[model samples]
Target chain A: MKMKQALLTLTATAGLLAALPAAAQFQKPEDAVKYRKAAFTVMATHFSRIGAMAQGRASFDGAAAAANAEIVADLAKLPFAGFVEGTSGTEKGSPKANVWSERAKFDAGAKKMQDEVAKLAVAAKANNLDQLKAAFGSAAQTCKACHDDFRNP
Target chain B: MKMKQALLTLTATAGLLAALPAAAQFQKPEDAVKYRKAAFTVMATHFSRIGAMAQGRASFDGAAAAANAEIVADLAKLPFAGFVEGTSGTEKGSPKANVWSERAKFDAGAKKMQDEVAKLAVAAKANNLDQLKAAFGSAAQTCKACHDDFRNP
Candidate 1:
């Protein structure tokens, strides 16, 4: 019985180890670009949902609100993990070549936006509708600023 | 006022009118989902930068912070414009079927998030770091609640 248990443990451990590299392997620039862009798109979509609620374009549901909020929080952290610098170049139909050219500036812009979003996340948990309205406005500006500089269209 | 100039202007207007629809043609679901995911990834990556600053993992610079904050603001709006209800299905590695199945709930969650981020943007403009921090925390929590239910790991 002990032997069987030990074998099971080993199998699980090996499986985990194997999976780690697959996840890690995507750290390449091309892959990072793909990952980052996907995450951003999701985050952007979620933001719209939130906007509908805040602006009275739509109503809110507590359970769904909770889920959307989580998406925002995770998005806040997604960018940091994939920060392989050259990944910027691998993106297609991206804003502009300037994203890579002014990498530091772009990074800095990204960071600021995340920080603000983080703040927005916290406010959201409280369900303070007024506060939420204000925070969303802040987050939206960050998107505009980056696109204006980095995005072509 | 001149006959030739008037004719030329009319011709240009006609040409532009004809070209407009093709230029503004909505993306198909496969393309929309793909493009949206790309945008989401960028937003997520950018969010990390702000997280770093907020946690004091890094320091803040006003100009950079402001710029990134702006990016978040614009990103908030992009997803909604491109939303084609059935498009999400065409994309790979997207959230679960429930995203469309329970779209009203999902939309509510999204709206709440937008409200919070917008508030964050306003706070950022005021240069109120304390308010920013508070708002950021709230926003983060809101995002988590949604992702727990809606997103795939």
Candidate 2:
């Protein structure tokens, strides 16, 4: 009976591990921090380009908007994998500890942002400024929501 | 005749601009530098994961290798655009001035790396360890060649 219980426990542990995101292994915790920041930086740069067009800060070039949106969508799936344990910071603008403590909510936020960004990509390709603006607004809200909830002020 | 010369000059300038890589605009030179560095950091992290598997330091996982390779290939197209004017540094490991001065050669090097990385992505999907290693070797060589020539010692 003890052996059977051990087997069942092992199976459960394996299932949990499989259920976790495919987090990339890091040589050090600092490496994970750097990677996540880098991913966010690149994603933000492209996303901001779309924001510029959406807000009329820059002229709306449909091709440029679509390209930037595609990049933003591709990158939306990356940074969360780097939110490894014990990597949170107390500094202003850093990821808060609750990212791990409230893992489910954090993940849900990430999924929400990714979904909105994907829609933004589709809207951008339509070559309509109004469609791009609407999608960008939705995606931007997802970003703000996650930041407000998960990041340090 | 002078009017015709002005028009010809304008056309040639447009052709030159068109021949250049599709670089993403940045608000400042520092922003361009940061963007490129972020891109390289992310690409390097993913590439190192495949390197670990290729070198037998990590157990080979075909799906993980393929995923990393795809990220690397996508990123290989990015950093070159950030090599904007006035961003070179004198520090060791910084991009050298020749990256701009020797523009044709630098662009060629970027193209070579991108091509090799694309092949690496395909090889990684083959689920054959030998093929992955071979492709990784070629891709690594391209990276090394660029670093040796265009990066400061």
Candidate 3:
């Protein structure tokens, strides 16, 4: 019993240690870009999976949807973090020079997107195909609005 | 004939006017983040849409796909301009203090993903579902790889 308790304690400590860097590490622009990109991609792929499930191209795929919902929930938190100012580093194909110039407006957009995505997570959790569809559409719209004004497209 | 020439002149002028801002705007971190978020969201959303089409839950939706492709192709260029050094500002959620520090790797990842998506666009033009599936999967994988190392999750 004592050995099992010790092992549990060790595992808990390791988990805690692992999380420390995640918070401190994501502070860099490159890291923020990486983190947000990762979360967005995961959400995107799972969203595709969910689309598949909804269309019945695949079955209910409850397991996949559940997994996807979990990812979406996490993604809701990422963009705000992506807004961590000073994180922007020189990349090969970044946006216009105006992004840094228009900081207030940009942050507002990010916050708006995060709010919508958060709502999407709730709808996704319900596992109602219709709800997911509606929520996802709304979230995608928020993404588009920001992209239209700020993104290169 | 004079009317036609005038129309031609106007169209050309409009095109130039449109192109000019893409070259001129968004110099700060705030502005860059806003713009980038838009581009990234468009890319992610379109990516999901293509996956939907490939799964056959939806129709070809050629117009939507083409528009999205155009947006993505254009947005791909935005990041390059947004990364000017010293432009990085003090945003709360964008990334961190380190993004500017590790700009090269971030740019590379973005490029890889963009290239993959461009491949998907070609497949989309062919309207070949199988090709779409293959390319989409490839593109998504790049997205996942970046996210795994960079994102919050």
CA deviation > 4 Å runs, candidate 2? A1-24, B1-12, B19-24
**Per-model TM-score on C-alpha atoms:** 0.45, 0.89, 0.38
Per-candidate local distance difference test? 0.61, 0.86, 0.57
Clashing pairs in 2: none
Model 3 compared with the native: what TM-score?
A: 0.38
lDDT of 2 by residue, B70-135 (tens): 889988888877888888998988999999899889999999999999999999999999999999
lDDT of 3 by residue, B1-153 (tens): 653564345334333323323323443455555545654664554466666766786666665565545444444433444444554444433444344577677667766766666666555565566777787788788877766654444
Reference-based TM-score, model 2: 0.89
Ranked by lDDT from best down, the candidates are 2, 1, 3
Over B17-97, each residue of candidate 1 has an lDDT whose tens digit, in order, gives 223222122436665656555655565544555666667765765554555555564455445434456555424356666
lDDT of 3 by residue, A1-153 (tens): 999999999999996785453344343467566545644554554456566666666666444455555545544554444544454434533444455678668768877877776786677767777777777677777777776766664
Query: What's the TM-score of candidate 2 when only chain A is evaluated?
Result: 0.85
Native interface contact recovery, all models: 0.62, 0.71, 0.00
Write model 1 residue lDDT over A68-115, tens digit each, in one string.
555676566664445453444424446466765787798788888888
Q: State the displacement of the C-alpha of residue B110, model 3, in Å, after optimal TM-score superposition.
A: 1.6
List DockQ for all candidates: 0.23, 0.52, 0.02
TM-score of chain B of 3: 0.64
